[model samples]
Target: MPSGLYRCIYYSKNRIDGGRTRIASEIESILAAARRNNPPLLVTGALVFNRGLFAQVLEGPCPSVEKVFEKILRDPRHGDVQVLGFEAARERMFSNWSMAFLGQSREDQNLFGHIGPQTGFSTERIEGDRLLDIVRNLAFEEEARAA
Candidate 1:
């Protein structure tokens, strides 16, 4: 029997509450953690941080995705966690990324108009499907740019 596949997209505040001038350190720490933790559980995903918000897609075995998401919720660095999308996916959109981080570069900011300077994970400003599309497109776009 094949395992069930699941995809979850969520948005959260992008502050490391009380941390000082170490956002880069904090983000690297999170990525390192994901790299170490995700593979064992067969989880694959990408994370985006733009306009002071975090939007991420977690896709893999249903249970594994849930487990990692729950960990994300418990982490104190993130706030205002909201699930944008959660459903069964036909396949992984970010199979190559354990946790790819998309920064607030000019290019990244231009990927979606909704992620402007003032935007911060508002459901009213971005729908679930659009959020998924943005992340998926970001993954591919970034890859193409890299290549």
Candidate 2:
């Protein structure tokens, strides 16, 4: 692990209410807030939403990552927040992004299906490392597509 860097991986039940428009707006609001708040704190992460669930990876200085996660725990848009992993990290996987949003594409759905097969996409049984790998892969794929 690096000097003061840490990583947090977690999943939460999505609590945003409304139709597609409302949900889309709420997600935008989340990305907007993360972009605004994380730069100063040197936090970078990726968020994936699928089947009414959210899986995310946060990386940064220990205190900054914890601060950001505390805010996440209090956010009403998320519930049943479960920390899959929180430990010192050697490096950030999403270093270039303040907060990357990985949209739910067919490929993503298939990936999630494989990860959470027993309970219809529930992240409860998934390991932190596995979830982290999935998020990292999706983020990288998104980056590549953009490039």
Candidate 3:
């Protein structure tokens, strides 16, 4: 890992209003922008959206990660954005992906379900490192599936 490498994990309430199709479109647009912007900055991450909430991990040079996260904070599509963690990291977990999206497949649903069983998915209830591990695993699984 480089000297300034860092990882950030956050979860936000989904504020994009519309039917499923519109929401899907918005999420796709987000991914498109991320894919376009991340490579130049050497940022890599995974994003998971479960209709009501969005959880994501970003790993890269510290300045680059901070820049991306600042944009995310200002984006209108996200509300009540809560950063779970932001700290120096020793390694890159999503190195193979600039931005990997975990969708609504059965496997993804099961992954999300395991997070919060009784009270549902609550950012307040989950720790940053745990979320990072989950997203990292999902991204690797996705990569394998694609391969």
How many residue pairs clash per model?
A: 0, 0, 0
Q: How high is the lDDT of residue 16 in model 1?
A: 80
Candidate achieving higher TM-score, 2 or 3: 2
Model 1 residue 34 lDDT?
95
Against the reference, the lDDT scores of all candidates come to 0.78, 0.86, 0.84
Displacement of residue 33 (Cα, Å) in model 2 is 0.5
lDDT of 2 by residue, 5-77 (tens): 9999999998999876787789889999999999999999998887678888999999999999999999999
* TM-score against native, each model: 0.84, 0.91, 0.89
lDDT of 3 by residue, 1-147 (tens): 469999999999889998888888998899999999999999999898884789999999999999999999999998888888999999988887888888556423646677787435573777787777777777767777889
Evaluate residue 104 in candidate 1 and report its C-alpha lDDT on the 0 to 100 scale: 40
TM-score of model 3 vs. true structure: 0.89
Give the clash total for candidate 1: 0
Best by TM-score: 2
Q: Model 1 over residues 62-109: C-alpha lDDT tens digits?
A: 999999999999998889888878889888888887888765455234
In model 2, state the lDDT of residue 8: 95
Residue 123 displacement (Å), model 1: 5.7
Which candidate, 2 or 3, has the higher lDDT?
2
| Candidate 3 backbone collisions, by pair | none
> Which of 1 and 3 is the better model by TM-score?
3
